[model samples]
Target: MCSNYDACTKPERLRMYFGVEPPPRIKSQVWPLYEAPFIRRHPHKDVGDDAVPAREAVAGLFGLIPHWAGEMTFGRRTYNARSETVAEKPSFRDAWRNGLHCIVPVECIYEPDWRGGKAMPTRIQRKDGKPIGIAGLWTSNTKATGDEVFSFTMLTVNADDHALFKHFHKPGDEKRMVVILREDQYDEWLDAPASRSMDFMRQFPAELLMATAEPDRGKKTR
Candidate 1:
């Protein structure tokens, strides 16, 4: 539930860390990241619209693969393609067929509490400015150019202790959070599946996350 991040007030910080510029206007109730064209730094590699990596795992925009595609809208259905059942659902089954692979580069994600007296906004981020990748599933969407445009959904699993203890999540519900991956886990998550996916996901350390409140701009730190 680390959703309360407002303005990317630290634009200069983002630029320094990401090496790419921040959004022209730093805003969004829910931030938007899209597939755009880019040239990679590696002189030997190819760079183009299809080559650009996604900024964040924007849920559901990317559909599941091997689509039976019986007249379904992409946006509504694609938002959450869970890891546990990706192999079972018809929509995602084929995606799981060859094994779905995707990465969502997230700044932060927020969640609200309807039962609370006053809603609190918290901003969660790594202490270091290292850009992290959240695991996801992707399908190839065709664009006018005929180059395969890939859209993906970030995977979510039960929240760890930090989140449950932070006054978020349903009382008894295991509740879910986006699956943020450690650098070491990327290969398996984006490569192997079914057998290895669950095992690799469990490797995340519970102690790495610090979920807390964002106080007023002065005096206190989030």
Candidate 2:
């Protein structure tokens, strides 16, 4: 699962890449519980008209905070939801059932390569150096202090048979990778219903991704 990643924080880049106006300020690096921007279908889009934009960008915590969560700390462990159990897990079921699909725009994703009997942080990005749009779920919650908080979680799929992602994680552990969507599928993914959302939860092509072994420099904090 991806717990840390480089976000596409520039407003102009976000506008061009995701087709939405992002928040004025967004962090470059995102960790669990960190603030980041996600693109989702406009809530009022159903009001009917081409005048309403189909998509909108909103800033939210990187992790997911279920409605039943008592505090923001609950998000720390909900950053990544397994596709197999997302619809059954307490932390993700509500969002999944409600079809709260979203796209998490990222410059690259960081994962650990556990070869050579040690762990090496690897930076994985598209071969073209373009931003990736990862599939995720978003939800809104009310805090004990009467503040409303929006949060999201990246959806992950089993990658045990994947050519590239199979090398990540521990030797015996199950391999997993985030669901990356193609540019053409962006709108389709957001508009997919709950029953069909899983159709997009598949691994990205290994040939389109390039990885470099770069150690974490303590620049990102949890």
Candidate 3:
């Protein structure tokens, strides 16, 4: 699962790439619960049957906040919802069935390799360094204070057989990676029915992937 990532896209680039208006400037890096932009169909308030889904860019927290959550802290652990069980998991099932699909724009994602008795942070991205659109589910919550919280969780699939992805996570843990949609597949992914959405959950070609080892700044000092 991804604990942090780089999603720093400029407003103009967001418009150029996703065709939606830009959200607020995101930091160079984003962590769980940090707000970031996502492309998704806007919630329609029109009562008419003529209403259509409109694509829009909106800022939402990286972690999902199920409407049933009594508090926001639960988001910390829901940043990623496994694709295999998302349709059945209580936290994500509702959104999954309701077609709350979203696309998370990521420049790169960070993971920890615990092979040498300690974790080494690795940055994974497309070989060309272009932003990748990760498939995700989003939901909204209203706080007691009248504030509304919009959040999302990236969907991941097993990547055990993937040459590149299988190298990131801890040794004994299951290998998994976020579902990255090709540019041509974005529209289909966003508009597909819930029943057909999972059909798009598959491993990306490792040939297009690249990785770099980085110092683990979060590692404790002696």
Candidate 4:
């Protein structure tokens, strides 16, 4: 479950990698409710009478708020959706079934490691030190003033047996972590049918990940 992360990639870099228009400059770091870039499927009009689906990088809130939710506060608890129950959860079921998928790009993710029987802030990144894509679900909510709010929630999977991820959570709590998608699989994730999407929710390779501890910070929620 990734609640905060580094989004230090320059807008030009994102445009080159995702092939979408450059997004506005983002902060060096992002927390819940912060606006950041996420890639989603969009329609592209060609010369003829044909429209093709293309990936586009757009800015959106980190937490999702279904249109049906009455208050924005609900988003505070929806920064992450469990992979196993996403299809059944009320807040995410509609978006999941509607194929509202997106990819969260980040330089690294922050988590808490309890290996020392005390929470320690840790930053997890790709061993190659490149930006990674986190699988997520997105939706649009209309405010009473008619303004539309676009947001997303990262998908997470149990990591009880994962060598690196399993050490993040508390000793007695179930271990969980976000599903990091490989670069090659990003397109498929955005267009795949909901019925087959679950197949992609697998644990990230621990060997490909590197974790470094920072000074302990106050507890953060996922």
lDDT, candidates in the order shown = 0.47, 0.91, 0.83, 0.82
User: TM-scores of all models?
Assistant: 0.59, 0.95, 0.89, 0.90
Kindly provide the TM-score of model 3 when superposed on the true structure, using C-alpha atoms. Answer: 0.89
- Candidate 4's C-alpha runs over 4 A off are 45-53, 216-222
RMSD of 3: 3.6
Q: In model 1, which runs have C-alpha deviations exceeding 4 angstroms?
A: 1-66, 70-72, 113-115, 142-149, 160-166, 212-222
Top candidate when judged by lDDT against the true structure: 2
Q: How accurate is candidate 2 locally (lDDT)?
A: 0.91
Candidate 3 residue spans exceeding 4 A from truth: 44-54, 143-145, 216-222
Error of 3 at 51 (Å): 15
lDDT of 2 by residue, 1-222 (tens): 999999888878788888888874568789998999899999999998888888988899999999878889898999999999999999999999999999999999999899967889899999997899999999999963368889999999999999999999999999999999999999999999999998998889999999999975466664
lDDT of 4 by residue, 61-132 (tens): 778888887677778789999998999999899999988888888888998888888878899999986788
Ranking by lDDT: 2, 3, 4, 1
Global CA lDDT of candidate 3, please?
0.83
Residue 208 accuracy (lDDT) in model 4: 99
Better of 3 and 4 by lDDT: 3
After TM-score superposition, what is the CA distance of residue 221 in candidate 3 from its true location, in Å? 16
Candidate 3 lDDT over residue span 31-87, tens digit each? 887878888976662434444435677888888988878788778899999998999
* Cα TM-score of candidate 1: 0.59
